[model samples]
Target: MAQETANSQENSNDLGTITVEAEALSIVTEGTESYRAPLTSTATRLDLTPRETPQSVSAVTQAQIEDFNLDTINDALESTPGVTVERVETDRTYYSSRGFEISNLQVDGLRLPMPYNNVHGDIDTAVYDRIEVVRGATGLMSGSGNPAATVNFIRKRPTDSPQASVSGTLGSWDRRRLELDVSGPLDDEGRVRGRLVAAGLDTDSYLDRLHRERGVLYGVLEADLTDSTQLALGHTWQNNNTDSNMWGALPLYDSAGSPTNYDRSTSPAPDWSYWDGETHRSFVELTQRLSDNWSIKGTVTHLDMLSDTKLFYIGTVPDASTGRIPNSFYLSKFDRHLEQWVADIHAKGNIEAFGRTHQLVLGSDWSQSRVQQSSLYAAATEDLPPLDEWDGSYPEPEFGDPDFVHDVTFKERSLYSAGKLDLANRWTAVVGARLSWLDHVGEQYGSSQDTTLDNELTPYAGLIYDVTDQASLYASYTEIFNPQTATDRNGDFLDPIEGTSYEVGIKADVFDGGADAALALFRTEQNNVAQLVGNIGGRDVYEGADGITSEGVDVTLAGELTPGWQASVGYTYLEIEDAEGEATNTYIPRNMVRATTSYRPASLDALKVGARVRWQDDIERERDFDDSKTRQEAYALVDLMASYDINENLTASLNLNNVTDEKYLTSLKWDQGFYGAPRHVMANLTWRY
Candidate 1:
């Protein structure tokens, strides 16, 4: 029996496919830039191959992650097509897709809530094996969110055989990094297994007086209770510390509405300013097999985050001659504790019905999350030192004890079910629905308010037809619901935003699944979208827009283009409009294209080289009440990378990003322009045993 089990494991590993519960726990994907992902449960809650599902899905494989040096989630998302990354501040970044913000994130198919205004999205990639992205609404899996996209992270697991590796990196701007990973069997018969990963980063930014330190640790253990049952437990911890972080961007325009030119290294933060954030997560999963064709799995997770900062808030357009600007100095601290419990059980099998064989899945899930948050701030608005030359030197001001600000709480409970069936001929069908209940409360020093939403159901449906052996056409419709925290003019919580999305696409696997291509057209309609109306009684009042619509076309081709070359290319065109037929969400580009390709020559044998390019069209922004408008011209950035294998165990790589050093602004909001990174060069060395 042991020998048979060992053979089964070896076969599964070689194919990168899971054959049993144990095999699912420790399978690694191979290939540097492959577009073919065999299995993903993020879209349907059932482990179906990517092409078999009627939705658009993309997997950023482990080989691609390492080849691109995607050290953080931000880096990975920036490289992904049909997605836009906006850097709000030094430590905060936001991602959007299809003209809407992406607010849903999952780990191992478990949905987790992340705050947009906090540091939760700045996750490190050391603990993850792959990132799966599903474009369009994933309402059946994610309880409440916009119809943008869902990103699922798959964590690394212990391997059947012992494996160890170490890596070091040196980069521009005083950047240094080190990482270690080890995984193997922990006991006889390989019933128990363990894995550990640790990494540290110390980097100085291109901006003046800005430096950062980051640390990450992840550990996991898996045990086989029986031949058909398994259990796994894991935890991840990450912390980030920064010195001299800016609260906002440099001045966009002077008092005369003329654009200001400042050095790329210019920053408004003083030397004494700092920000720190920490996150910890723990999770458990279990899998049981009842029959040869039937199996079930369950997972639970807990997450906590804390943050603190002292900043010199820069405000007001500066004088072009004197360079004097208004400054507000303050110290703030925030503590957010979230406890989430989720339970799910499902059975899958093939049954003969009506003279045909069909795959059926029946499952139900229940989840509840509670968040408790509080914050305090100490401020001094008067007697600030300024009206001088632009420099990184400033005197620290005395601050008293922080005052009580507010206390807030939020909760969500959801139940969902989904299924997939093979219809007659080459046609397939998928259907699912979810019911959710949400509640929230906020107490501001002495005032409090409560809001609730009960029993809302979101539905999903899709149809697919296999046109040929290598091509399939599909169409899907999905819905989404998201509650808003913004208040109306009456001081009452605004109604939840409701969205419906329609998508039609064709996917093809070429070269015996060595490459994949997809073309999709989508339209999304959103109602009750909250928009800031004005300030009433010193409080902001928001009103819902009548409707917003986003229509777009996306084309992607990835995997091996030829025998010795791999490439991924994507293009996107989007149009968004409000109820009045006026353009909306103009910050996001209307036309964008990205391409990445790598080549390993048959002659060199040990040398590999690659190049990447990203281009976006011009974007225009118009204020709600003003006639003045701002426009960011179109631009393209280029990158290059090369690697040389010294031996079977040693490898060296070099990467140069922003080769042209383009000075275009990546984000322009409220008259402030955030410049993109100028240029970066990173070199890495790795050894394996």
Candidate 2:
């Protein structure tokens, strides 16, 4: 997992009979020096290029990351098509794709459910070689849940030769960042290799009194026990501390159900409010070559995350005449810790039957996670000072004993298998199924409850037909099941929610095979979805929905457009409806486009310039308090960058974001909302060897 093992580095646009004697090492795109990668294993268990895979897949390569300065996961996802990053608060976020939440994330094919808050603070990209997103039901590889999308983060590995680089950046709002990366052979025989990556950032925000500090580190070592066997160990750590963290966003409506006009920098946090987070992960992997056509890889990983927060909350619309809002105000302090362990083992190989070769993959995985938390709360001593008069100059609450405690554990195990067979001339079939067992047991808020489910099966099927040497037509169907904690009217747990996805499309190797293009029509159907039935014993009961649907169209093009030029562009149109045929999740935009392009002229080979544009249609969220919807109009943002090689080893670049200074709310998912970032600029310099 930390060294390259293959026949050799293959060109990105080349396509032919695909074989994988190099699966032991996986695919590495570190030094490819291209905006596009040639191979990926995230869409399917087999090693195939984006075009060869029967799904809508997208990749952000190392070159694109560096050139675009996408230093954080949020920054990268914002550039991906058919995806949405909702910043509901200062430190918490939610990601949605194809009208559903992305519930899990993977690293090198190892899966972990999303953290308690989905995402917090920052996830540095320095440790990753590339990030791949498989849009649609990836149940064939990922066990269950979320028919939206699957994200795979490929970690960087040691290089066959010594390499070193250092970089520094200064940006708007007193932002400063430094990063380092180095990799090399650890022994004279080149049988051992190592890589190290680290980054540090300190920054203030466009919001008043908000500040953040972050640090990250990643390390990996690989050793070859035998010529055909290898072992690798790796660990990663990151810490984030924020001052004046906003627990909740600003109020959107006033006493008269009219919108409130607050400056973009307006904040709801007190002077002493804070949020801090830490994450630690360690992994070990072993790969063995059973034969020239067969190989096995086993992996074990542990993840731990901690968050300590003390914050404030405000609710209800303010009164217009009294100068004092009748809203409820409160303060609370809580600390949470979560831990997870995951293990996976798999074997893949090729076989000959009927004078043709076919690929088969078999694997099993198990995972367990537990979360513990304690909280302290106090209602505001009095109504919060008038909204317009408040300046965060208020008395601190004298907190009492623990208000609540939570301890819960969840476990899931599954066995999955898939095969790619040559059905006939210019035809191929991909089919697979997974059987999973899941359970949740523990005391949550002092309530002891246990739930379990077994023998849940998910199936996957797909077919591809070669329309021409440069084009292919394909269709696929996939299913995923999500276990439920919700109870029925009889106090019995309901069955798992089921999601089935269908897609048909055409993919082509265009621009003389230097690029790839695809157009897909996709639809998803969900049943047994939870819905509010009625209140029983002063508690709301839920019943399954008959059916819910989401359908959309997607078009994308990516790769080298010409000599010294690269581009990636995507567009999407989506609609979601419930059993009654009424629109659902209206907050999700129906139309979106993400495009970026860079050019390095032949006359000025040492200089590069690029631009990016992101646009989305109008979206709205219903406000029960106002009896209306808080609507945000369509908006578009543009960014530009340029870099110049000062010498053989030094390079300088500058990036300007939100060139139009578009002003809009970050989200309206909740009754409260906040504004997005304003215009900003970042300058960076690097030295490499």
Candidate 3:
């Protein structure tokens, strides 16, 4: 097996435990710094092998997020596999892969700028230390969108011995958390190294009177002057806050739409309606090395977010004589602001062309973003009555009659470049492109042809074939372009929306190296798409002709097939079509499945056990107000976890989520209706130094 991966990278570079240290490399020993190795043994963003990247890549480690005690990042993307995360309120969250919606995000690998409203609730996964996902259409290396997946987030560096760790958690609604991480060598010939991480969280949510608080800080610095030159610097900061948050979603019936049963603590807004939010982020990066195969890297980032809201929606006849109670409209204030910037430059090497070794990459990227929104509306009174639940002690309504005031702005800019060519020794190829420009403006206080501008060009390509060395076969093509910021059915402004995706895959690393598998088939097409030409004061305005297509097949499996056992699985099968004009073919069931398993018992080396299961199938919407409405049904869920390790720096954990508290419905919105988070329990403790 290629001499067992070259004797496992020469026993991880002569047992220096994968020495890292590189700022220009002065390390005389410790495996002699072979370009700071360790990117999980090749596959560093597609140099291939993770059974040859091509697509559908998943890696989530920090020991699988502390062996599944998974402290958010949406619980480590639920152990990834065609991901789906929808928390749409409680600080809003929505993620989907394969079924769309997942605007490629990246951290260490750059890219990040998505949040056009719907205040992402401050994405906190406790400052990441690992998390990677790449599924379908990564526009070569992420530039545009939709083939659904791309996650990437890796941070945590600085090592040379001195280590420190701390963790604490208590879950289920009144959650609490604390985290700290520290790392070694700041001098003393260690060529300067450092690391720090911090986190704090406080929660009290599960709907009905929500609450949240968050914080994160990170720092890293590394230096090594000669022997090939090296220097690194890093910084990160984050903050999040939320108070009684909720905005739409949670009303699945009754206005004659049928199916309605209430009581999930029913809260269609009324304790005065107030939702608040805040977010801030900063980042920086640099890496260099000019010889022995070459290298260079740089990154800069900044982000700011703010939101203030007062939402209340629930208009479906709740009393004008009982018509099934559901009337309470209000939006008396909503504000938003977002800003982002990004820059990148890169180069990597390894040559020897047609004769053998080849591995090259070149990159360039620049990004910009700005978005602002201001809104105000009010006009609902029939002697008040619309606070069925959500009791975060309300008290803030009062806007008797004034309705209409709006302002909006959005801007985007981009320039991108990418390349990869491995060839020789199993072929690999990738190419990328992106160039975008967009602007939008909207004003209403009596509107007057607002403003808009658009431009686009997104492209990507991929190919990989290693039919042996543990199997591989792949193919990809991608593109996406979006524009048109609201206002249509005659209000003008709507165009720019194009999408395409095609993928094929087969990857393997089964029972010989233990486990890893993949099988994929995909097809996606979207053109202009934007239907809905009705409601205009109750929201929902669309016009831009439609065209949609989705086809899918995905299957995945992961890791350790024996010794102490471990497993992961995912399955998806989807077929959706709605080709414009008369709403043609539509078959929506986007089948989904998930599985997880774990066990540790090599003569009891600190106990462990795990289990998880998930299933989906049941989504039928024929909108335009009905075609036999059915939204979210078909469900299955299970989870369990356990851990214990009392030596080498403490450990204790337990988790059980939705362990059959199945009242499903992870998301739905035509004005709220999101549930899922029933049975819950969490406990954790860790200390390491």
Q: What CA root-mean-square deviation does each model show from the true structure?
A: 3.8, 3.1, 23.2
How many residue pairs clash in model 1? 0
The lDDT of each candidate is 0.74, 0.82, 0.62
- Greater lDDT among 1 and 2 belongs to 2
Q: After TM-score superposition, what is the CA distance of residue 682 in candidate 2 from its true location, in Å?
A: 0.4
lDDT of 3 by residue, 1-689 (tens): 00012222121111122122221121111111111111321123333445545566766655566655666687678667777776666666767676567777777667675653222665566566567677655654555556567787765566655778898989988898888887777776666667788888898766666667888787777665544444566666666766655666555654556655555655555545555555656665555556656666666777777777777655453332343343355556777777777776766666686666655555666666665566667665543343453343435556543455455444555555545566656777766676666555655454533444444677777788888888878887877765545577556767767777788888877767767788989887777767777877676678776576777888887767777777777788877667733322222347788777777889996887888787877764443344556467788888888888888689898988778888866565333455666888989988877
Model 3 scores worst on lDDT over the 10 consecutive residues at 28-37
Candidates ranked by TM-score:
2, 1, 3
- Where in model 1 is the C-alpha error above 4 Å? 1-18, 21-27, 30-35, 117-121, 328-344, 366-389, 401-404, 444-449, 485-494, 530-545, 623-627
Candidate 2 residue-wise lDDT, 1-689, digit = tens? 43342324321111121122444125566655466666677766777666667888887877778887899888888888788888889988888888888876888867776634278777889999888888888877777777888888888877767778999999999999999998877888777888899999999998878899999999998777776777889999999999988887888877777777678887888888999999999999887877778878899999999999988888676776664666387688988999999999999899999999998899999999898988899777667665556776656787788888888898989999888888899898888898999888987787654779898899988899989998999999988777676788998878988888999999999888888899999998888988888999987789987666899998998888898898888999999988899998888899999887899999999999999888999999888776788888999999999999999899999999999999988877777888988999999999988
- Model 1 TM-score on a 0 to 1 scale: 0.91
* Cα misplacement distance, residue 21 of candidate 1 (Å): 6.5
Predicted candidate 1 versus true structure: per-residue lDDT over 31-115, tens digit per residue: 2345335567787676666567777777666666677787988777776778877776777776778888888888877777754
Worst 10 residues of 2 by lDDT: 10-19
Which candidate has the highest lDDT of all? 2
* Candidates ranked by lDDT: 2, 1, 3
